[model samples]
Target: MIEIFTDGASSGNPGPGGYGAILKAGSHYKELSGGFRKTTNNRMELLAVIKALEAIKKPNQTITIYSDSKYIIDAIEKKWVYGWIKKGFKDKKNKDLWLQLMEYFKLHQIRLVWVKGHAGHPENERCDELAVAAAKQPALPADLFFEAEAAREKLF
Candidate 1:
C-alpha cells in the first residue's frame, strides 16, 4: 500500500496558501508542493490530498492518507460528501477541489487517517514545513476559483 502524509498552510483565511504531500511506498518516496497567491486553508488541505493521489502512477492502488484536516477526513468518513454530491455541492466552498478529489477517488481504494496537527509526527511535521515554505515563495499563482468567488462576492 502507498502511504501519503499531507499538510496545508495559509498566511490568512484568504491569503497566500500552499499544500505539501509526501508519498511513500516501501523504499520509494516523493514530495510534492505548490503555492497559491490567494486561497483558504481548507482548499489547500483538499489540494494536498488531490496532488498526492494524482502522483500515483498505477491504477486501483491501495492508498492511505494522513491529514490534519477534519474538513476532509470527516467529510469522507462520515459520508457527508455523498450527500453533497447528490445535492450538487450547493453552497459548498471548495467545490473545485472536492470534484477533483472525487475523480481521483474512483481510481483508488483510499483510507484516511486523521492526525493531530503540531503533535510532532515526523512526516506530518515535514509536510507542514514544506507547505509553509511554499506559501512564503514569491510569484505564487493565483487560485482561480478563489479569485472568482471573491469577485462574485464583491459584485453581489
Candidate 2:
C-alpha cells in the first residue's frame, strides 16, 4: 500500500504557486515539490496529487492521497470531474490536470481523503511548508497554460 500527503500554496490568486507531496510505501519514502512563477491555488492543489501519483513506480498498487483542498478532493470524491468530462469540460477549470489524474486512475486503486489544513496534522503541515517555500523561491518556471489563458483573457 502507498500513502501520500499533498498540499498546494499560492502567494496570491493567479500568482506564484507551488505544490508539495510526500509518498510512502513500506520502507520507502519520497517528497516532491514544484513551483510555477504564476498560477492559481486550485491548479497547484490538483498538481500536487498528480506529482505524487507520478512518483509511484508500481502499478496496480493501493494508494491513498490526503489533501486539504476541497477543489481537488470534493470534485473527485463527489464524482463531479466525471460529469465534467462527459460535458467535454466545457466551462470548467483545471481540465489539464484533471485529465492527467484520470489517466492515473486507470493504473491504481486510488482514494482521496480530505484533511483540515494547519490543524496539527504533521504530514499535512509539512507539505504546506514545502509548498509555501517553493512558491517563494526565485526564478520559478512559468505556468505556460495559465499564462496563456491569462493573456487571452486580457485581450478582451
Candidate 3:
C-alpha cells in the first residue's frame, strides 16, 4: 500500500498559500509542492491531496492519505462531498477542487486518515515545513484553482 502525507499553509487568508505532499510506495518516495500568490488555506489543503493522487502513475492502487485538514477528511469520509456533487455543487465553495478531487478519487482505492497538525509525526511535520516554506517563496504564478473560481463567479 502507498502512504501519503500532506499539509497546506497560507500566510494569510486570501494571501499566499501552498501545499506539501509526501508519497511513499515500497522503497520509493516522492515529495511535491507548489505556491500560489493568492489563495486560501482550505484550497491549498485540498490541492495537496489532489496533487498527491495525481502523482500516482498507476490507477487502482490502494493508498492511505494522512492530512490535518478536517475540511478535507470530513467532506469525503462523511459523504458531504457526495451530497454536494448530487446537488451540482450549488451554493458551495471550492466546487472546482471538489469536482477535480472526486475524479481522481474514483480512479483509486483511497482512504483519508486525519492527523493532528503540529504534532510530533515526522512526515507530517516535514510536510508542514515544506508548506510554510513554499508559501514564503518569491511570487510565483497564479493558482489555477483560484483563477477558475474567479472565472466561475463572472458567469453569474
Candidate 4:
C-alpha cells in the first residue's frame, strides 16, 4: 500500500498559491510541489492530489491519500464530482482539475482520508510547509485554466 500526504496554501486566496504532496511506498519516498502566480486555494488543493497521482509510475496500485481539503475529499468520497460531470460541470469550480483526476480513478484504487490542518500531524505539517515555500518562490507559473476562466467570467 502507498501512503500519500498533501496540502495546499495561498498567500491571498486567489493570489500566489501552491500545492505539496509526499508519496511513500515501502522504502521509496518522493515529494512533489509547484506554484502558480495566480490561483485559488481550492485549485491548489485539488492539484496536489492530481500531481501526486501522476507521480506514481505504475497503474493499478493501492493508494491512500491524506488531504487537508474537504473540497477534494468530500467531492470524490460522496460522489458529488460524478454528479457535476453529468451536468457537464456548469457553474462549477475546478472542472479542469476534476476531469484530470477522474482518469486516475480508472487507473488506481484510491482512498481519501481527510486530516485536520495545523493539528501537528507530521506529514501534514511538512506538506503545508512545502506548499507555503513553493507559493513564495519567485516567477511562479500561471495557472492557465484558472486565468482563462477568470478572464471569461469578468466579461459577463
Highest TM-score against the true fold, candidate = 4
lDDT of 2 by residue, 1-156 (tens): 899999999998989999999988899889899899999999999899999998887789899999999988888889999999999999897788899999999999998899999999999999999999999999999998889888977899
Error of 3 at 142 (Å): 0.8
Prediction-by-prediction clash tally: 0, 0, 0, 0
Candidate 1 regions with alpha-carbon error over 4 angstroms: none
Rank the models by TM-score, top first. Answer: 4, 1, 2, 3
Judge candidate 4 against the unseen true structure and give its global Cα lDDT, from 0 to 1: 0.94
Error of 4 at 22 (Å): 0.4
Cα error, candidate 4, residue 105 (Å): 0.8
Which residue segments of model 4 deviate by more than 4 Å? none
Question: Which candidate, 1 or 2, would have the higher TM-score against the true structure?
Answer: 1
Q: What is the lDDT of candidate 3?
A: 0.91
Clashing pairs in 1: none
Q: Which residue pairs clash in candidate 4?
A: none
Show the lowest summed lDDT stretch of 10 residues, model 3.
Answer: 139-148
34-120: candidate 3 lDDT, tens digit per residue: 889888899999989999999998889999999999999999989999999999988888988899999988899888899999989
Q: What's every prediction's RMSD, in angstroms? A: 0.7, 0.9, 1.9, 0.6
Clashing pairs in 2: none
